[model samples]
Each structure stands twice: as structure tokens, then as C-alpha cells.
Target: MSELPAGLVEFLESAGWGGAAIDPIPGDASFRRYFRVRHGARQAMLMHAPPPHEDPAPFLLVAQWLTNNGMRAPEIYAQNPREGWVLTEDFGNDRMRDWLDDNPDAEVSAYAGAIDALVALHRLDPGPFSPYDLAAYQREAALLTEWYCPAVGLSVDEEGYRAAWDEVLSPMLARQQPGVTVLRDYHAENIMLLGDPREGAPQGLIDFQDALVGHAAYDLVSLLQDARRDVAPELERAMLDRYIAACAPGPEFEADYARLGAQRNAKIVGIFTRLYKRDGKPRYLELIPRVWALMERDLAHPALAPVARWFDANIPDELRASGGGTIA
Candidate 1:
């Protein structure tokens, strides 16, 4: 168990849950830490997101934004910004990842609910979040060279990588004129099945502190080409068709989807490598090959020809499959 940070009890007490049994939740790749707090029959989640490294404000801002816009971000019960502690409504252990594993029958409806949530979120004007602009996209893509390349004992064509991204992403960026609210990390693990018994499986959103105003297809890519788990190709196809049918987007949406999918997966590959090499966390390394596979799938699209060529020239086929495992 992690030790309690100072003044945590007073913070909880002020929030009317003093003397609560605070049990730590496992940490994710970020610096934030979460805990389940229970005081008699009442319960809530305690978020210990120490600042200077992890700010609770973005989480608070995005949560409030989502709730106000008729979405399902966890309700914030109390907060201490100075110390970076927040008490929020707990969604329990019903993550869509585990929910699908136990209830395979509900996979279609559950994913439908998730896709519906994205559809609804994208329709509204984004809240006061920053734009996921071209610069941001390039910076994220550079993670592959910055972190992953060095760790794998390979030196990639850094300039070529940037040029390739610019060639592919410029057109995609143009197609997403005036962005929408994109939950940057909208995958099964971060989504919870709320079991509302409605036609769509209402989900509870978490880990959306990184939400931004971006392309509609970006979140769809995150959902369908998830690194944590493989979304069935058939289900992925059905969902894409469903989203296209529902939104009636521009003709380039699929191409944009492929482009953003490649970008996001490449970013994850870098991030997971950073976690293992810099942060001393090996678990994320295990997911690298999966992300590489997903990125390759996206790169197959003509929209990603430049990036695909860079990978072919830079990384070998054997490395793409087992680069993460090779780190040790």
C-alpha cells in the first residue's frame, strides 16, 4: 500500500468524509494516483494528482465540461487544487475491457454505446480546451524518434520522419475544419459500462484529463485500434460503418481515420518505451508490439505512404514485431 500524503485526512474531512478508509488504486503511465474512499455507507474516489508534474485542473476542467455538455464524466464532489487532491464519484470495477471479457454477449451493445458517446460528444462545440493542432500532432509523432528509436538501439531518419508526418497529416488536418471534443484516450480500459439498461450501453468516462478539440475520426481510431486489446476486425468495420452512417461526415473521414490511427499508435509506441526506460515501468513495454502492429495496419492506407516509407527505410520487420521485448 502507498503511504498517505500529508494533509490528506484533513482534505477528506473537509469534504465530509474524514476518517474514510482510503485504499490506493494502481497508477497508470502518468504521475496521477487514485484511491477508493469509503466512510460507512458513503463512498467516493480520491485522486492524488500532485502538481508541477500532473495537474488536477485539466481533469477538473474536462470533467466539468463533459458533465455540463450532457456527457458522463465522473462527478467531482470536492477538490484541493493546492495539494492536488480531488474527491469524485466512483464508477466501481466495471471497465469495458473487463466487462467485455466476462460478458462477450454484450460486446456489440457496449461498443455501440461507446461509439454513440463519441458521436454525441463530437456534435457539440468543444469546451475551452486547446486545439489538437498540427504542431501538437507533429510533437506527438516525434515521440517515436525521441524515445523509442534511441531505446531500440537504432537511429532513425529524424528529418524524414517529420517530413513524412507533415505530408500525411496536412491533408487530414484540413479535412477536420473546426475541431470537436476528442477524448484523446477513449479506449476500452478507460470506459466503464454503467449498466443503465438503455438501448445503448451507457458508459462512464475516465482518464479524459487529456481531452482536446480535435478530429472526429481521432477518437474513433483510439476506440477501434486500441493498444490494450484487439477490437475484432468485423466489429471495427461495423462500428466504422455505423459512425459514417450516423454522422454523414466529409468524404475524407476514412482516410483521416487511417492517418490519425497511425499517428496515435506511433505516439503510444514512444510513450510506452519512455515508461519502461525512463520511469522504470516494464509493463508498458509489453504492449509495444501490439501498438506497432496497429500502426502498421494504419500505415497500409495510401494516406500514410510517406510515413510507411520512412518505417520501411528505418526499422526492420523483426524489430517492429519484437522491439519492446528486446529492450530487456
Candidate 2:
């Protein structure tokens, strides 16, 4: 029998879900928990984001902001920010990722549909969030050296790492403000394949509490260059073209896409290594090779020249090729 959290029963009663049955659901890469709540014929997903680590307030606010603006963010039925909990509408089991697995032939169309959601999302005036600024980018990019380097027992040039990111990212400093609500984890796994494709918001977006007013290219990179899955190169290009046709964010889209892709990949590598070495989760280590592949591809872009040079000098090809394989 799964034990309910303290006050959860009362909380459910107060939220009109009194005596609801709660079943645990697997959480994501964060300090949060989830449960499926059932009351009669109704089912809703409970987001248990305990504070001092995870905050449900931002998730609630951002979710409503999205729904109010005609997006398909989950509907929050009730919340206790103090407990970092919220009962939200269940989006069902069809993640765009699993949907793709069953419908391999539908990959292109599924991605195209996902891109449509992105297009619709970016068109909206962004909600309140901190800027994904130069300092933030530099801080994140340095994580590669901060965690991954030490994990692999290689002492890298941390200063060069920051310098490279600075050079590549500094040019776009003016492109900072008025960015769209970047669903920071806007990948297939986080997207729910809701009903009819022709209906209102065919996609149900989730895991967006970390959203920020950042480069429009950021989420596009996230979707195309996924860390958890492989997106074909040709399809990646096609989707880029499709998004360009729809939103036309700017002429600098391609460069920014590559630049941010590299930066985000670096962050993921560090975080994954940290998950293993510091948090005792080794499964994430397996994803590092794929992330490195994507990072290298992004680094090939002209806009990533400075960072590329740094990687060339500091990180040996054999080390990256090992894919954290040698790391304990």
C-alpha cells in the first residue's frame, strides 16, 4: 500500500476530491513527485512538487497563463503552493514520443504537428520569466567542465570554456528581451498527443515550469536536437524550414539554433554526469554520448566557432567518443 503524504487526504477533501484514490506516477528529472488521483469516473494528475527544491507556484502560474492565452497547458483544478502540490487535468498516456514509436511512419507528420504547436506558442506575447541571458548561458555552458570534466578525471581549461561561450553568445545579446515563453523542456516526451489534429491545440504541453524569456531558437533546438531521442538530420532541416515558413522568427534563426543547441547540450552533459556521480543515478550517463553527438553537430555551425575551437583544444575526441563509458 502506498502511503499518502501528510494532509493529502484533507487536501483532497478540501479540493472536492475527498476520498480519492492516489497512485504514484514516475517523476521526471527534478525534485518532484506525481500521482494519479481517481474519484468516481474522474481522473486527474497530481503534481507534487515539494518546495526547498521544486516550486509548484511557477508551474501553476505559467500553466494558467498558457491556457488563458489559448494554449493546451494542463488545467490546474487545485493547488497548495506551501506543499508544492497541484491537481491538474490528466492529459492521458499518449506522449508524442511513444506515439512516434507506434507510428514510425508518422514521424515526419508528428514532428510537423509538434512544430505547429511551437509556432502557435511563439506567436504569443511571452509571460513573465527571467531572461535566459549571457551570464546564465555562460554559467550553464561551464557545467560541462564543472561536472563532466571532473567525472571523467580530466582537468579542462574552465576559463577557455567560458571565453568560447562568451564569444559565440555575445553577438546575440541584443536578441535577449521579448523572447517567447520557452518551454525549457519542449521535447516529444513532455508533449501530450491530445485528440483531433484539426481541433483546438492538438498538443498538450507539460514540464514548462522552467520556462524563460529566451531565444526563440532555444525551444526549436530542444525539439529537433532531442537528448532523449534521435531526430533525423533531414527531418530536422525540414522542420526548421517549416517553422521558418510559419513564424519567421528572424534571419538569425539558424545560427542561434546551433549556438543554443551546443550550450544546452553542454548543460545536459554536466547535469547527467551530476545525476550519476552526485545523485547515484547512472542511467542518465548513458545519454551523454547522444548529447555529445548533438553538441558536436551544433558546434560545427559558424556561429559556434569560438566554442568549437575551445572544445577542439580542451576535449579530446577519444574522451567524447567514450561517451562517459569509462566513468564509474
Candidate 3:
């Protein structure tokens, strides 16, 4: 086995896990790393962020918040904040994406469960977090110009891009009702299908340290308009209808959904491009076409005229082709 970080190993020994086998788990895009600890009749997941790079407090805080809300975030077993280590209940390997792939017929029921989880999540107080207000939305959407444009060798009217988004999104932001806890990464990979959906049992959630107070439609869009996988159009529509029926979010909810969806896709396209050109992770580029396709659908909404205009003026059809038209 490769040598574990000295600090992490010391933490394990001090925490009475010296003999437990530490097997590294696949990591995500962030700086954090995960390991599965197997000891005699004991199993847990260790999240090692290696401080000065990543912090554990936000994850702990959100975990508490989710647990308090009766959602199924992992239960924290032990923590060493200074070392950036957190040992929590292991949810095992049954990711929602894997489950969906293995049992395609369960798509409806699985998504229905996830939608029910959203209904429950929205019903709770959002706790203390910054609101996903107009400025935040604009700043996030700016990634398209800030990163993706330069990568594609396209010049952007950065000022005009922000202005267009402000014009299109200002009124929508103003009309937004009280925000709910928006799990920023609510797609299939972060969700674990833990139990039967028919029984109304909640599912396990992970990778939600960046939870924020935002529109109810935000997480719904994250799930349906995934950057990694293709959620069938029919399933996406059904799940969306399910959430609307369950939550009955005010009359303007559909517009909010489309707006947030478009905004998120814009941010992701830029991020994926940045990952390839800046971080040397090219595989994410493969997913841009799928993400941009979703963006097109969302931008088609009449409410997104300004954003659509920005795209038209900046990113030509050829520039938007898969792999982002030669990032040379």
C-alpha cells in the first residue's frame, strides 16, 4: 500500500484505528480525498482534506444540518479539524448513478425518491448560509467568459455579458420566494440509493459541504440537468413535474427553474473547459456537449433572452462544438 499522510496515519492510530485497513476511495474534483477504513466489524469513511488546502468545518456543519432535518447525510464518528480529517459512517458503494445504470427500469421510482427528498429538504429552515442572490448568480455565470472564452480563443465582452445577465435575471431574482437549502452538487453521483423508494424512505446524500440558501428549483435542475450523465428527457420531465406537484412552489417556479438551469450550465461549461486547459484534466471536456445541450434547452425559455443574446454574440456555433472547438 502507498504511504498514507503522516498526519492522517497519526490521527488513525490515536483514534484507535491503527490496525484498520485504509483503502483509498475515488476522489472528486476538489482537493479532498476519501478512504474506506475496515476494522474488525467496523466500517467508516475517512475524509482527508489536508488543511491549508481544504477545510472540514463546512462539511461537518452541513452534515449536522442535514441530520437535524432528518435527511440521510453520513453520521460523523470522529474528527480532527486541524488535520482536516473526518471519519463518518460509510454509505457503501451503491451510488445512484451505478444503480440507475444497472437497473434502468427503476429510473422513475428512483428519481421519484430523490424528488421526495427534495420536498423534505425544502420544508426545513435553510439555516445560516449566504443567499444565492443576484450577485452570486452573476458571478458564477461569469465563468463562461472568464475561463471558457479564453480557452476557445474567443474574445468576450465581459462587461456586456454581465450586463445582459443582470437584465435578464434581476426581475427573476426579485420574484424569488424564501430560499431553501440548495445542495450545490445534487446530481446522481453524489446521491446514494440506500433504500426502497416505494416505502417513502429517504436516500443517502454526500458531497454537500457547499450547501447554500437558494431557490428551490436550483437543486432540481442539478439533478435533471447533470453535467456527467444523460438523464432521459422523459425522466427529467417526470421528475420535474413530481417536484412541482409536491412542493407547489409559487406560480413563477417554472421560470426560476429554467433561469437557474441555464445559469448553472453556463458556469459548468466554463468550469469543464477550465479543468481541461488549466488543470490538465481533459476527460471533463467530453461532457461539454451534453451540458451545452441542456443549456440550449434552458436558454430557449423566453425569460433568458439576454443570456441567449450574450451567447449568440460571443460563442459561435462552431466554437461551441464538442470538445469546445480546439482549445489550442
Candidate 4:
């Protein structure tokens, strides 16, 4: 662990949370770190974010937004912006993944609530919000070539890849949909199931610091085509249908969903490749085949036929074969 920031201990003491046993919590891809500070029967989460690589403003803003909108994000109890330490409400360890692992029946039912939450977000008119524009999308999509090519020590046909990407995204962008307050990573691992299995509301949502004004389908795809946990096909179909029904009645929903799924799967392939090569996190590699399979399936839909053809024509045989034998 790095040096404890100045005034953190003093601040905790001032807040009456001092002398609490602090244990570091594991972090995901972000630069921010967390520690669980236990104080008798109560507990609080202590966030440690070092300079430059971490920023708390977005987290604070989004928390305020979600809370005001009736979602159950952790409330900020104490904060020191200079030291980048924040003491927040502890939502506990009952993550959706853990709960579903313990009680399989809860998996399908619990997702209904999450899907409802997403519908609420998508329905909101995103006035004055920043868009997750083309530049950001392209930068994220480039990660596959950036990391995987270098890691494998194979030179990528840059022009060919770019052409393929443009070929797919161009038409899709032509029919670009409206924006919403996209949670960006609304998957099982980031959600917590609060209270008892038989009763109580699900109360925790974390790792939403990267929220953006993006397509409604982005979060839906993140939830259904999860990279961390496997949501069954029957459940995924049901959830997708549930979301479509919740949206304003429209003829374009199915077509948009297919296009978004292909686009999202493309982005994930790039992201997972980047994680493996740049971050040395090889666990994501295991999910690539599954994601690719989904992408292929989505592409087969008439809406994404161009993308399917581009992939078949451009992506090298070696790269396709690297999909761990799970790509059918």
C-alpha cells in the first residue's frame, strides 16, 4: 500500500469513525482504491484516489444524480477533496454475483429490478448532458489493435482494420439514435442485492463513475452480454424483451437493439484485448470467445449484415482461431 494521505486519519477521527479497523478492498480497472473501515456494528467505505489518475468529481456528481432520481447509490458522509478520501455509506458484500451464486432462482427475478432501473434512466430527457461522441467510441474501439497486436508481437493490418471498423459503424451512425444517461457498466458485479434473499429491496450500485450520455442499448447490452458473469440465454432474451417493452412504443427498437449489440460487442472485443495486453489482466481473454460469438450472432441479424461481412472478410484466420475454441 502507498503512504496514507495526510489528514485522512485526522479526518476519520473528527468524523467519529477513527480507530476503526481498516482493511483494503480489491479494486477493478480503475485507479481508485477502497478500504472497509469497521466501527463496532457500523461500517463505512473509505475511498483513496491518488492524484492525476483519479478524479472524484464525476463520482460525486453521478451519486447526487442517481440519489435524486431515487436510485440507491452510496451517500457521501464525509469527504476531503484535497486528500482524495471519502467516507461513504457501506452497502455491504451481497453483490448480485454472490447472491445469484448462492440462490439461482434469485438471478432471473433480481434482474427485473435492474432492468426497471435502466428503463427509468433511459426515459429521462438528457438535457445539456455531454454525448459519448464518435471520437470517444473510435478511441475505445482502437484498443483491440493497440494492445493485442503488440502483445502477440504481430503487426496488424492497420488500414484493413480501420476500413472494416468504418464499414460497420458508418451505416449504423447514419441512423444514430438519441442519447440517454447511460450507466456505461450496468452489469451484475457492479450491483449489490441489499437485505434478505426472501425480502427487502436491492440497494447498492457501484462502479458507475464512467456514466455518459450514450445510447440506451449500451447499458442493456452490458447487462445481457456480461463479461464478468454469464446470464443465461433464456433470461437474456426475457430481459431484452422486457426492456424493449418498457421503452416508448416504436418500430425501430428491435433493429436498434441488433445494431447496438454488434457495436457494443465490437467495443468489448477491443477493451478485453487491451486489458490483457496493456494491464496484464489475462482473465478477460477467456470471455473474448463468448463475446465474439454474440457479436457474430447479432451480426447475422439483417440490421448488422454489413458488419458480419466485414468481419468475415478482414479479420485474419489466426485471430479468429485465438477465440479459445468457443467461437462457433
TM-score of each: 0.96, 0.96, 0.96, 0.87
For model 1, give the 10-residue run with minimal summed lDDT.
193-202
Flag clash pairs in model 1: none
Over 4 Å off, model 3: 196-201, 321-323
lDDT of 1 by residue, 95-169 (tens): 999978888888888888888888899889877889899999999999989998888788889999999999999
Q: What local lDDT does model 4 show for residue 71?
A: 78
Best lDDT among the predictions, by candidate number: 1
lDDT by residue for model 3 over 175-257, one digit each (tens)? 55577899999989999877655556558999998888988889999999999889988989889888888878878888888
> 1-328 in candidate 4: lDDT tens per residue?
2565566678789878978878888877667888888889988998877667887777777888888877789999887766677789988988888788888877767888788878877777653356777666666666656665555465656666666556655554443356788778888898887875446476578888778887777788888888778778899889988987888636665666776677777778777777666677777778888887777767778876655666667566676666523211
Candidate 2 local lDDT, 1-328, one digit each (tens): 3476676777788899998888988777788888889999999998778878888888888998999999998988999999877999999988988877887877877788889888888888888888888888988888888898887788888888888788899888677567788888889899898863434338899999888888888998889999999999999999999999998667777888888999999999999988888888888878888998899888889999888888788888888676644666
Error of 1 at 107 (Å): 0.9
Off by over 4 Å in 1: 196-201, 321-325
Number of clashing pairs per prediction, in order: 0, 0, 0, 0
